[model samples]
Structure formats: structure tokens, C-alpha cells
Target: MKEVPASGAFRQLEPGPIVLVTTSYRGKPNIMTMGFHMMIQHAPPLIGCVIGPWDHSYSALRATGECVIAIPTIDLAETVVDIGNCSGDTVDKFERFGLTQQPAGSVAAPLIKECLANIECRVVDVVEHHSLFILEAERLWIDNDHREWRTLHHRGDGVFAADGNVLDLCDRMVKWRHFPR
Candidate 1:
């Protein structure tokens, strides 16, 4: 086995798909690309994500305690990376990317019409030390008609993998039969 730096661990075990997080404070809305996030609970639908002060949207998220997590498909890969490359502090990402903003019902943050799914969330708790925000899903919106369903997975260092093929093993799961497929 080859020894690897601990700092490179994230590239080996990157969680879920790359997502776009939107926050609105005062009257201005902003969006940032997030690669560090995961589902923490199912009953209340809690999600844990890392949004530090370095991110321009962090202040808005902390002040308002609300944000929208938008899941973009493979087709929007370039736009997603471009959104992350620039700061919302200097650029109006929505306008710069020509992304359509749809009003969210539970949060002031706008949903990206181009994304595959959008989850409106409210911050339930914050771990200041780690800049971890625990969010509860308040609402969810999905584009049932969208043809592209593949999502992007960040592999660190600007590399990414797109979802491909299907592995249906639902029947093999004896313990998870009670849950929806």
C-alpha cells in the first residue's frame, strides 16, 4: 500500500454530488458552489454542510439562517465550476451566469431553474468551530420533466466525475425494503 497525505483524504472520500448553495441577506441574493455536504438525518431531513467565512455566502447564511441547496446535473457542469471560481461579493452570479432564479417558498434564497432539484433549507444549528451548519429541509422542488439526471462529483484539484449507468440492486436489500427505492 502506498502512503498518501492525510490532506488528500477528501479526494478519496468526497461526499455526494457537487451542489450550489444560495443565500439572500438584506435584498441581495448570492450563490456559491459547495462540495462538502452530506445528509445527517432522515426524519427531520437534516443536512450538514461546511460554509466558512471564506465563502461570500457564509455571512448571509449565518445572518438569515436559510439557504437553498440546488443539485445541478452534468449538463450544467461548466457553469457550476465557473460559479465557484468567482466570488459573489464582486459578481452577481445569477446575472453573470444567466441562470433563472425561481422564488423559494420557505426561504428567501432563490432556486436555480437550471438545476435538477432544489431543497429549501433553514439552519437549525451551527458548529462555529468547524463552520458546519445543520440545515433542515423546509421544502423540495424537482424538475420531473428534465431529461438530464446525471450529477457531478468533484474529485478535487478541479477534476470531476459525472454520473453514469445504473446499478439497480434494490431487490438485494433485505433490510431497507421498508424504505422507498
Candidate 2:
């Protein structure tokens, strides 16, 4: 894979294809599709996400320091794209989309009940970089029941991939083009 310089101008390095992250402050709920997020460490298990300060939820996330990372399936591609394209400041996305916001453990931010897997998060660090706000959230609560499901993965150019047929990797490693078995 070609690596892009991190310091270069913001260009779609690669469509991150992560599930949507939701947050709420004082009963006001907000949701946004995020791709540049992942597990950064394992000792205590940490997650890092990036959000533009210009976004409405940025201030709420910074102020409340809490959020819920909702894992969406490929079926929700349209809604996920919609959430990303629009602004939560002017719209009540939850109500508009008829999404159910349910209670969570670690943070006051409600999790999307419709999503299969939900992880409650508490922001532990905030780093200001240019116009973006980097959030490091500790995974507080995880509601995972690994039912037969397909997760949404961004394929760039406005496309998503859900869990497809299982490729049995029970052998530990699949045949690789570069690495010899």
C-alpha cells in the first residue's frame, strides 16, 4: 500500500470506512459518520478518532468529553452517508431519521439502539491540530453479541462493504502473494 505523508494537505488518504459515532449533550443528540478512528493501544485498550472543529458535534464532544461509537451495518449506508453529508447543528438527525437513542453506561451520550454493536466512550485526551480535534476515548462499555451481521466498510467513491461470505482463516494464515508459507 502506498503511504501518504501525514503532513500533506488534507486529501482523502483512504476512505476510513468506520461506523458512525454519536454523542449527546444535555439531551441533544448528534451522530456523524467517522472513518479515521481505530484502536491505538491494547494495555488498557484505547481508541482514537479525528473530528473537524468546524463540525457541530466537535464542541459538544469537547465540552462533554463523552460519546458513543455505534457500529452500523452495510444496510445503513444511505443513512450513514446522510449523517456525514449534513450538519447536526441545524437538524435533529435522530428524530428526523427515526433513530432510537438509548441509555449507555460510561457516557451520557445515547447509543443508537438499532446498531448491533455499541461501545460507550469517554474522551481522555484532546489534541488540537490545525482545524481538527483529535479525540482519544477509552472504551467504557461494550454491547457486543456477535450475531450474524455485516459491518459497513467504506470502499471510497461513495460505496460500502458489508460482511461477506466467511473466508475460513482457521489455518492461521492464508496463502499470501508476497509471503511464502
Candidate 3:
């Protein structure tokens, strides 16, 4: 389907696993939430995150060249917004949000204690396209312990609809305008 660029589209951003970003600056640690992330490959897994330069967490994620993205659940909606809304540079998001930290397997960034899953990533690439920052993360450690986990996929605006009700698809076709968003 052809994409129509709409401003302020209140898209129900699919609720994804809210990943906590832990970064260390000058021996100090910081953690942030990221929903705009994905895994590109399985073998020698490649991860991707869009880290905008203007964001508080952006510089940390880039400058440190290291960070941890811990996946949270729907129950963490409040914490997700708390970490995602506030700047990590000035505020201790972890402490302010009452999050506990755990040692990471491969990097300096710490993992959030209550997260459902954790991904330890090392920066491998950065891309700039039309005022957006895209960083490629090399997944070194991945832990998915939560038995019943749901993914958060962006649906637009601040709305993130949790992924539920599994579906299987075969061959398919539909008119763009008629297709469900």
C-alpha cells in the first residue's frame, strides 16, 4: 500500500515489549525506554534502533557506543511513559521510576530487573536520513524469560495496542484504501 504522510495521526502504536535502555556516562548509569526497535537477523543477530540526535537518550546511546534495551510488558505502561517522556541526562529515570538494575553479560549498560526480556547491544552502524538517527545494534545477549509475553508494535500517536490473539496468514491481497490500518 502507498503510504500517506499524515501529521499527528493518532495511530494505535502496537504495544511492543518496552525495552529499557541502560547507558553509562562518566561512570554514572542511565536507563530509558525504547519501543522503536527491532531485530534484523537471527544468526549472529543484528538489532536496529532509531535513536534521534535531539533526544536525551540519543547522545548517550551513541556516545557510549553501548546500551541495553530491556523489554517490558503492558503492566509497565506507566514506567514506559515515565522513562520515555523524561530526559535521562538530568533525571535518574531508574531511581525515579523505582527500577532495579542487574549486571549485563557483554556491555557496561545494566538491565532492568523487572523486564520480561533483555537485549545487550553494541553499536555497529549509524544512519542519518531526513532528521532521523538510525543505529544498528549487534545483539550479544538476549533473554526471554517471561512465559506469557506480548510485543509492542507502533500504531501511531501515543497509543500502543498490545499484541494479542495470534493469527496465521497465507496468500493474501487487498485494496490499499479498503485494507485495515
Candidate 4:
């Protein structure tokens, strides 16, 4: 085995999926690519995401206290990268990318129709020092027709992976059937 540099090694620890976060504030809707989000809990569905203070959508999210987390399939990989490269502060990403906006049931943030799944989240708490926002999923919309919808997972730099393999360990593990969904 070979050794690698320790700089920015945190990215290797947990390279999570890249999701498009949509924020709508004062009649303006914006979309931003986010890779620093994770599921914090199952019951009442909690998600923890990191959004820098300087991000354009951060102000809207912090002010409105809501946003939509859209999971995009591999087909939109290029568009996702493009969206991430640019800033919503200067560009109208939704119009530029031709993404359809669908109104969410619970949150003010509009959902991206092109994505595989859209999760409506309301800010539950925020850790100011860490730029960590804890959100509770108020609504979840998934494209059930596409069972094989592959999504991109950012592996630092410009590299991304289409989640392809499925390894089930249900049989070997104890099933918690009583858990609330």
C-alpha cells in the first residue's frame, strides 16, 4: 500500500452525494450544488448540511429558514458541475439550465422537477461556528418510475461517480421492523 498526502483528507473520509439545493426568497428562486450534506437521523427525517456564509443561497436559506434538496441523476452530471462552477448571485441558473420549478407542499423553496427526488426541508437549528444547518424534512417527492436512476457522488476535485453497485446485507443483519418510517 502507498501513502497519500494528508491535506484535505477529510474529503476522502466521507465523499457524499452531490445534490442541488434550491432556495426561494422574496419571489426569487436560486439553485446551488451542494456536496456537504448528510442524513443525521431517521425519525422525523433530519439532514445536516454545510453552507458557507458567503454562498449566495445562504442568506436566503437563513432568512427564510427553508430550502429544497434535490437529488439529481447521472444524466444531469454535466449540468450539476456547470451549476457548481457558477454563482447564483450573478446568473439565473434555473433559466440557464432549463430546469422546471415545482412548488413544494411544506417549504417556500421550489423543487427542481428534473431531479430524481426532492426533499423539502425546514431549518431546525444551525451551528454558526461550523456553518452547519440542521434541517427537518417536511416533504419528500421521489420519481418512482425510475428504479435505476443513478446519482452522482463527488469524490473531491472534479471527480464524480455514478452510484452503480448494490450489496444487500439484510439477511445477515437483524431487521428493525418496528422503526417508524
Scored by TM-score, the top model is 1
TM-score of candidate 1 on Cα atoms, chains taken together: 0.96
Give the alpha-carbon lDDT of every model.
0.92, 0.73, 0.67, 0.89
CA-RMSD of model 4? 1.8
Alpha-carbon deviation at 95 in model 4, angstroms: 0.3
Question: What lDDT does model 2 reach?
Answer: 0.73
Query: Count of backbone clashes for each model?
Result: 0, 1, 15, 0
Considering summed lDDT, which 10 consecutive residues are worst modelled in model 2?
A: 8-17
Cα-based lDDT at residue 44, candidate 4: 84
Prediction 2 TM-score vs. true: 0.77
Backbone clashes in candidate 4 total 0
lDDT of 1 at 89: 86
Lowest lDDT sum, 10 consecutive residues, model 4, at 172-181
Off by more than 4 A, model 2 = 1-17, 130-148, 168-181
Candidate 2, residues 1-181, lDDT tens digits: the string is: 7877776523354344467778886778899888767566654556778888888878888889888888877667788888889888899999887888888866788878778778777777776773333344544444466443677767664676677787877476555443432
lDDT of 3 by residue, 1-181 (tens): 6676665332433234556778877677887666666666654657767766767767776678788777777777677777777787688877898888888877888887777767677777676573233334544343456654665555544566677897755235444444333
Count clashing residue pairs in model 2: 1
Each prediction's TM-score versus the true structure = 0.96, 0.77, 0.73, 0.92
In the range 116-179, model 4's lDDT, one tens digit per residue, is 9999999999999999999999889998886558888898777898888878866655677566
Pairs with backbone N, CA or C atoms under 3 Å apart (clashes), candidate 1: none
Ranking by lDDT: 1, 4, 2, 3
